[model samples]
Target: MTGARTADPPYLASLRAGYDRAFEATVVATPPEGVVLSQSLFYPVGGGQEADHGTLVTPDGIRVAVVDVRRMSGAVVHRLEKGGLVRFRIGMTVRGEIDWARRYTHMRLHTAQHLLSALAFDRYGLRTSEAAMSGHGGYLDLEGMLDGEEPIRRLEEEANSRYFTQPVQVESAMVSRAEFEAMPGRSSAKSLPQGISSVRLVLIEGIDRCPCGGTHVLSTGEVGRVRVFRDPKGKVASTRLSFELLEEREGPSSPP
Candidate 1:
């Protein structure tokens, strides 16, 4: 199968493929105790840290816990847990399983961060230069020097307004260089990957156009509820916007 970066595109978890039988895979190479799977739905840890967690089920009815998922030279490598090694092997077809519950939650939270960042940039013109995902939460570093409570509160309001209105739509597409360029206020050339032949553009309709290699939902509504845990006393001008997606709530009782 063509190495469709499609898996990493935002909204893939909400994608039908996630619920389908194992997607597609090819035997890459055999390691000491496990096998390397090519074209895996598993997202190996990249950018900073936090590896993807899941399990790999073998044809022999044995399951190996995917302790660590990482990347090297464009290939995703899964390290199996001890005592679960025999179940997996090179040249053997196995089912790649992900903790959808955990993975989906991450997708929702991650997308929420993007939306919040876009809001800050749009309303306050904050210029963010770096970001990283940690276990506690994710944070972005902006160049803007800020010091006050009002600014933080303002950012919260802007994000909640569009969020509640359900205006954001996270969609993906594989477009040519020209098509990618047509989007308004698109990331400039200096930000783009060098020698890029084709690009995958993830559009946050009406807000931002980002070249992202991560899973996301079809629409902003799927994000359920968002909690912006902004830290006003953040050490310098840099603001730390920690957030999480609230679990879906049950419907209330209907009137008699």
Candidate 2:
């Protein structure tokens, strides 16, 4: 994908809290399908993760549905829904926002992914190849093959234990690729984009650490219980482990 959070250019603001923050951004470029923004809180489709969907509204309240967000040459491109091509203009300033529920769901799942990847490597010496998430569930593709439901069951057990069981905090930081390489962690199946010399590393207190760019919850407990699917057939050349979140139904979780 686009490396990790460290890969973010200095000109753009951190999307860590973009869903709650409103910013005025000028349109930098407009193709037939989408427009590039000066800065974006929307997580684009990268690292096997899906792009965010949302709306862009003018200061006058004129709004357009943003169907997709993609990254091209370091810029975040917002693709509008069908019709309304003229709703935006190159130089026009608008308020860019993302679907909060979708973004937060991804945040939770992505963090869980980091946990899963770390567990696989720590317990089985397998490194993650690729991953993608939706809603409260997603899958992790690793380099090795897995057999039987027992392995997956063990994953569920370790994941729940390794994840937030005692209210530990989650953290993100930018580090050069050299530091990323030196540190102990799981590496994704895909390499970071060319020319990227830095990475954003996500850390879970007492659990695991890895480089990632997707949004994530502040606390590990908010990630809830990680449940893995019990199917050996899902394994191909690479083992594809699927997992979902069983969020605590009690109340809202505090941000880390």
Error of 2 at 44 (Å): 0.9
Judge candidate 1 at residue 43 and give its lDDT: 61
Each candidate's number of clashing pairs is: 3, 3
Segments of candidate 2 deviating more than 4 angstroms: 1-21, 162-165, 188-190, 230-237, 248-256
TM-score of 1: 0.78
Off by over 4 Å in 1: 1-21, 24-26, 32-34, 47-49, 134-136, 164-167, 177-186, 229-237, 248-256
The TM-scores of all predictions, comma-separated, are 0.78, 0.84
Q: By TM-score, how accurate is candidate 2? A: 0.84
lDDT by residue for model 2 (157-225), tens: 877885645456777777887777677556642466667797777777776777777776667676788
lDDT tens digits, residue span 1-256, model 1:
2331222422332332332324446556655534577567776665432566787777766767888876654556677888666665557777777766555555555566667667767777775565556543577665575456677667766666667336466766676777676755525545667777676656677887666666555566656655566656555767666655445522112211
Which residue pairs does candidate 2 place in steric collision? 6-200, 129-189, 218-256
Instruction: Find the 10 residues in a row with the least total lDDT in model 1.
Output: 247-256
